[model samples]
Target: MKGITLLAVSVFSTAFLSFTPLNKKYIIIDAGHGGSDAGAVYGQFSEKDISLNIAKEIHKINKSQDKYEVILTRDADISSSLPDRTILINNLNPEMVISLHVNKSPEKETPKHGFEVFIQNSEGSKKLADKISKKFSAQTIVERNLHILRETKAPAVLVELGFINNTQDRNYMTSEKGQKEIAQKFVEIINEY
Candidate 1:
């Protein structure tokens, strides 16, 4: 009877393992600009710093979850070329890619504000953009032939978080609370996928 019970337990364990789905959705979070490439700058704030902070936060929060696997192109202040980033992204073959950047208008105090989502000419990219844009106020989704968007193997979207030149945007992005809020929102959105 003991042997029969052991065999039954083994069979149950095999069946359970077969039915469990261990596949995690791989996602690439590319932080725009780094090192000398400060991207948009306003006063003491640099786009590179802001983007990396947010990207790291997202990665940190997502690491605790089992459904999604988050990867960042550059986790430090070092500069990484676009081609190199694209190659790594394609090699990983992630399910989705979101590039983070801060926008800057021609004028520092320009009235132009809010986020923008740029996507490639594919339905998958558009769908991803639509989902992301819906969460933010004053978001514009447009088609762009950017190298990252064009070369990536998965549905990709370049999100301009906000204008660095604008006072409201700058204040929000620079603050730690605001960064955490942005990261939390992104994590919530990612979990939906």
Candidate 2:
């Protein structure tokens, strides 16, 4: 939206987005922030690391299933410009685009915990976001626009997995079991479309 700023400047290109064979059903899992851009950080954990771990798990769970083929914006911890990410995602024309992220807020600024699913000003995206929110027991926000949501040809949503600053969110996201469960939930949501 108006006030929502993302890491849009890209020093990387389409090469940063790993591609696979063209499939009938496709999904693009964008692991937000990487390389020097650690995103939200708490202690030894970085938002980039958590996002990537969750994205990779989602890819692994769904890739071999033959329904929705998945591709990543960045395979590992590396920076890819926002334009490049959007360009690559739009080009794929995936069934949907889900950007993985972790939220952060100042401790004194009413620190937010739990999950949030963000959608652009579109009906389909909102529906999708809502479905995912229910799946995760998260809160859904309908907003003006995000680079990934506005630029992607497919339905898009940015999932704030949880707030790193929040103790419960931080623990759940960092745990192996929690990540797998989150990945499975996404697989179910993705296959429904």
Candidate 3:
């Protein structure tokens, strides 16, 4: 009886371990700009800093989902070349890639505020871009020809969260509440996919 009970326990434990959700689905989050490349700047805010903060927030949120494994192309304030970023993504072979950035519109005085998602010039990429754009329409504008999207081996998109030159955009992006909301919304989008 004792032997049979031990065997049953072992079998149950093995099954549980095997079936546990470990978030094996890989995702690469590229934080655009770093080091000398401050990207767009508005007032006291730098586009590179905004992008990294938002990417890190997304990473933190996704860590709890147990269904996604998030990787960042540039985690710190160090610079990474465009080719290197592409190579890293190719090596990881993630299910999806999201490159975060801030937009700049010098010609437009009024706030050009909206989220923009870019994909490769292909059917698959367009479909993904459309879905993401539609979902984030209230906060985003859809775009294409982004380098990260074009170079990544996996299905990828570049998200221009908002324009740094716009006063309202700058304020919202730099705020803690706005960053959290943006990160949460992105997590929702990934979860849906």
Candidate 4:
């Protein structure tokens, strides 16, 4: 009986450790737009504010796991140039980079209000993008010629959380509940990979 109990405990401990790998560390979270660059503004809500809030939430979640060394591109309300942002990401060389932003569209009726993930023009990137998009159907994931994607040395993705200009999107993105859901979903996708 004693031997059986010891074996059961060992098996459970090993299984738990396998699911949570120790090597997975260092994630870069880039909050798009800062300082003077307000990004897309809908009523009183600005894209920069939304992005920062979501990024911070993501950081908090990742920290709780104790598996990732999460770093933010910009911690305060300061403007960072495109080149500067890329440089910062490159310097960090994290295992994964996630750039967060809110979308905007001129056509009010264009029914495109969801999260989209953009990866570098590569096969591996596409695979990662597809996995994340499928998990979060709220946003469509597509590739774009983004500076951050091209400049980052690590496997990176840029996420447009939602369209600030869209009335429905704006309401959800600015709300605390909505932001928490988005952040939680994002972490799940990352963990899945």
Query: Candidate 4: where is the Cα deviation over 4 Å?
Result: 1-24, 109-111
Using lDDT as the yardstick, the better of models 1 and 3 is 1
Clashes of 1: 0
Candidate 1 per-residue lDDT, tens place, 1-193, comes to: 6556445545654564467455645789999999899998888889999999999999999989888789898899997778778867775667899999999898644556888999999988988898888877536899999999999989999999999888898888889999999898888878886
Q: TM-score each candidate.
A: 0.86, 0.85, 0.82, 0.81
In candidate 1, which residue ranges exceed 4 Å CA deviation?
Answer: 1-24
lDDT of 1 at 12: 53
The lDDT values for all models are 0.86, 0.83, 0.79, 0.78
Overall local distance difference test of candidate 4: 0.78
Per-residue lDDT of 133 in model 4: 79
Worst 10 residues of 3 by lDDT: 8-17
* Candidate 4 lDDT over residue span 151-181, tens digit each: 8888888888888887788889899999898
Off by over 4 Å in 3: 1-23, 138-143
Which prediction has more favorable lDDT, 2 or 3? 2
What are the clashing pairs of model 2?
10-81
Report the Cα RMSD per candidate. 11.7, 5.7, 11.4, 13.1
Residue 189 of candidate 1: its Cα lDDT? 78
TM-score, candidate number 1: 0.86
